[model samples]
Target: MITLDFDGFKSEIETPSEDLRIYNFWATWCAPCIHEMPYFESVVKDTKGTNLVFVSLDDDRRPERVKAFVEKKGFSSPIWLLSEKEQKDWKQKLKEDWSGAIPATLFVTAAGKRHFHTGQISEEKLKELIETYK
Candidate 1:
């Protein structure tokens, strides 16, 4: 897990040189979101050297609390805190059908392609999806 915020995310995912950009939107408060942590971590572990940017959708007013939550849980994946505007903007860009769901994840590679999962994903299935990209 590598820590990144809005600008860093732009540099990584928006970069022309990078390949396989993954964005996982999560929060510490959501149970389902918490449950999906291990899955993303497993993805990071299994897909070493792949580009994955994890962003925290927690309220910006409580960044310290969010940071503490991650620390308490001993999370292995790095996270970026999203501003309210950032969250709203992404929800629109991703899909209008979304109700600003938590535990939402998106994957994009240098090929300028995209993949999305709105709910929890199994480890085996994630491995297959990642390998497909490889």
Candidate 2:
């Protein structure tokens, strides 16, 4: 299991040569995002060697909530609260038409191959994803 704050994401992800990156972008206030977090963490802990990250889309205005939820859920993966600038850049980078939605996930390879999921995810699908790349 890994713990990632926002400050730690880019560097951690960029340092890997070819690891698959499973990034879940979420917010503290979004009900579905909050609901699905523990399941994401559970899969990460159960799997042995896959990379997982949780990027919190909330700003400083909601840090407490984010922190509280992270602790409450006992998340063991990396968690980050994103920068507004970085968030905007990512929205443009991932999809110009994206409305900055929370609970979006991107599965990508180090060389930039990408697969996107725009809503909540199930544990079985996550486990399958981790296995397929292993």
Candidate 3:
């Protein structure tokens, strides 16, 4: 897992690409985020032509704990730990109305369209969004 500040994260995913990129924002302490882990893992394995990345918002001081959690869950998608400490600064950068919620998802289409969902998303909805956006 790589640790990224806001700028690093933006640079990572903001570049133009032909693939549909899905960034799932989560943390180890967030239960709903944890609950949706397997769904994301399953989708990443079964889906084609799409890139899924898990962005962890866990405390920077506990990098080892975050690594252990991801290892225990056996996540296959690329994982990046967000090191930004101020939610107010980065929340709007992700979305205008984002409330700093966990289980949020940012979908970037090949066509350069962006879709953001804030809160727990069902596996069905997740698949549906991918099909619709990809």
Candidate 4:
């Protein structure tokens, strides 16, 4: 797992890649985020050639909790702690329509196509989106 500041996150999102990348913004305290995590895990298990990045929005002071939660959940996908404090400052940089909502997802394709979702996503929806990009 990696910890990234706003600039690093921006660079990652801007960079192009051949594989489909799914960036899921979540926090341990968020009920909706927790509720939808299993769907994400299932997607990770089912998807063959995609990158699943769990971008954690937990408090910067509680890194251990985030690490523990990831470990406890047994999520093999690479996890990232979003270290930026000023969410308002960087939210627009990520996506103009992003409202800084938990359980938000950003899908980036090899061809640079970007899709943003701002709520809990179903497994079927995730698969559909992956199919569109893959």
Candidate number of the best lDDT: 3
**Global lDDT of each model?**
0.70, 0.72, 0.87, 0.84
Checking candidate 3 for backbone clashes, the offending pairs are: none
lDDT of 3 by residue, 65-114 (tens): 99999889888789898875855688888787888888899999988789
lDDT of 1 by residue, 1-134 (tens): 34444555556665664556667788777887788677778677767656655688877777788878878887766677766656656576565677777777777766767777787666787677677764
lDDT of 1: 0.70
Clashes of 1: 0
Clashing pairs in 4: none
* Local error of candidate 3 at residue 114 (angstroms): 0.8
Model 2 lDDT, residue 22, Cα: 84
- Write candidate 2's Cα lDDT for 4-111 as tens digits: 443455565556556677889888788988888888877777666557788878775556777887888778777766665466565765655677777888777666
Ranking of candidates on lDDT, top first = 3, 4, 2, 1
What is the lDDT, from 0 to 100, of the residue 6 in candidate 3?
A: 83
The clash numbers for all candidates, in the given order, read: 0, 2, 0, 0
lDDT of 2: 0.72
Q: Give the TM-scores of the predictions, in the order they appear.
A: 0.80, 0.76, 0.94, 0.91
